[model samples]
Target: MKNKILVIEDDRAISELLCMNLTIAGYETVAAYDGIEAQRLLLWNEDADLAVVDIMLPGRDGFALMEDFRAKNLPVIYLTAKDDVASKVKGLKLGAEDYMVKPFEMLELLVRIEKILERTGRAKRILTIKNIQADLQSHQILKDGIPVNLKPLEYDLFILLLQNKNIALGREELLKRVWGEEYLGESRTVDVHIGQLRKKLELYDEIKTIPKLGYRLED
Candidate 1:
């Protein structure tokens, strides 16, 4: 099962983007646009493995929300546009696992999440999507009980597609996650690896390209 993450941000665009990206990273997400909605989700709707909270919120604010989250003994990360040293210090002092300023890179966010989960012993290793079994611990994949040998980049690309099943991923997003943000590579790099994945895995129909967009994976 994917880890469940609670996202408390008032901006709908940011919240939705976080949900989409986190889901693509194989984490289930519950988004709350305000503090009251956040409270309701925590109180009666869903349990969360971790929370990403924005310092500014409607109705109650992020710090107040942290009190309730702390009661559950849940891990928290503060994501806000606030870049002041004092705000960062206070949030860390208040027990947040990490603090990220806005306009951050998605790859960094993912790395931080993995690190926090690893520290808390909540990191996931086995991922089963459709007939594909990904054992992260071994960096191997099995399709329908048969091993599928993939080149290093092919395996990385395949995992990203499987995790974001049904969602269209752009070349930029794939590049950042798979090739690292500093890779300065061409979009064709993604295309070549994607082609390799389709041919080797027989996923011609399962993986699709969206016109003017990028690629989407179907179950």
Candidate 2:
């Protein structure tokens, strides 16, 4: 089952963008354009695994809404333009899982969300793509119900590409993520591993090499 996320933001454009991206990331999303609607959703016992909330709103503010979330044991990540230390401290003190400032990286936000869900035991354990199935908890992969042997780093790279499929990922960022930051490996290392993945999985056509970028595993 896809994890459901609630987005409570007054800005319709930002809310839509977040919902669309979250959907693309294999999540179900609900949007509340204002605090009043958010409060109503909460009162109605809307089901949500996590919430991305904006501080400023038409009705009740995020801080005030935190009480309602706490009452229901709902996890929250504050996404706001307010970058003040006091606000940050207060949001954390209010029991927010995370706090992100505006103009944030969408990829970073998606990663943070995935981490929070995993930490909270709310993330889905199995992922399926065509004939492939990945068991995240066991770190296992299967193709056509048969086990597929992969190196540890290969598994990590495969999972990363699967999670961020359809989006181009840079070689430098891939190296930093799959290999450790201190590995000091060349970008060619990524290419070699990607080649291995394609050959092993018969995904030579699905995984596209983006010129001047790196790769994108298309859905």
Candidate 3:
């Protein structure tokens, strides 16, 4: 299952950007523009693994929302513009595992979140299936502990296949999901990438070509 992240930020653009990057990183995400909405989301949907909260909110402040997350034992990382020593001290004092001021690098934030999740024993950065070692954090793939270098498109295809293991995914559907539908390319583009993956990573046995369909990566 993918780790789900709850983002509570009032700024529409920032919230959307965070969610987009989180999705690209292979994590499920939900967003609430205000603390009130955040609370509602948390109360009803209790499976959120972590939260990225902004201190300045419309209805409920991020500090107050921490109480709710604490009650549910959810890990949190404060992502706010309040870069003061006092505010940082307060957030850390309130049991936040990590705090990042605004204008933070997305990659650093992801690394910080990964470490917190790892410390809490709530996440595994390395995804394994058969001999495939997919390091989600590093975006690296390995076969039988040996490095497998893949082009960006090839890597994306490989990850998509693993994400839908044992399920048939049509080439068109693969193109839509991995390469985006607006991308001007034929379904044969997927076939070419799959061939490269099978050849380079020795995934020929696992990735089965579906007749009249797309493909399925069997475990």
The candidate that wins on lDDT is 2
**In every candidate, how many clashes are there?**
0, 0, 0
Regions more than 4 Å wrong, model 1: 10-26, 31-40, 43-47, 101-120, 166-189, 210-214
| lDDT string, candidate 3, 1-219, tens digits | 678999999999999999987776667899999989999989876878899999999999999988999998999999999999999999999989889999998856776877787788778567767787998779999888888999999988887776556666788778887898699967898889999998998878889999999898877
- 77: Cα error in model 1, Å: 2.5
Model 3, poorest ten-residue lDDT window? 160-169
Return the candidate ranking by lDDT, descending. 2, 3, 1
Cα-based lDDT for every prediction: 0.85, 0.90, 0.86
How well does candidate 3 match the true structure, expressed as C-alpha RMSD?
Answer: 10.4
What lDDT tens digits, residue by residue, belong to model 1 across residues 57-117? 9998888888888888789999999999999999998889999999998767877887798
Q: Which clashing pairs does model 2 show?
A: none
RMSD of each: 3.9, 1.4, 10.4
Best by TM-score: 2
Clashing pairs in 3: none
Error at 190, model 1, angstroms: 3.4
Off by over 4 Å in 3: 124-219
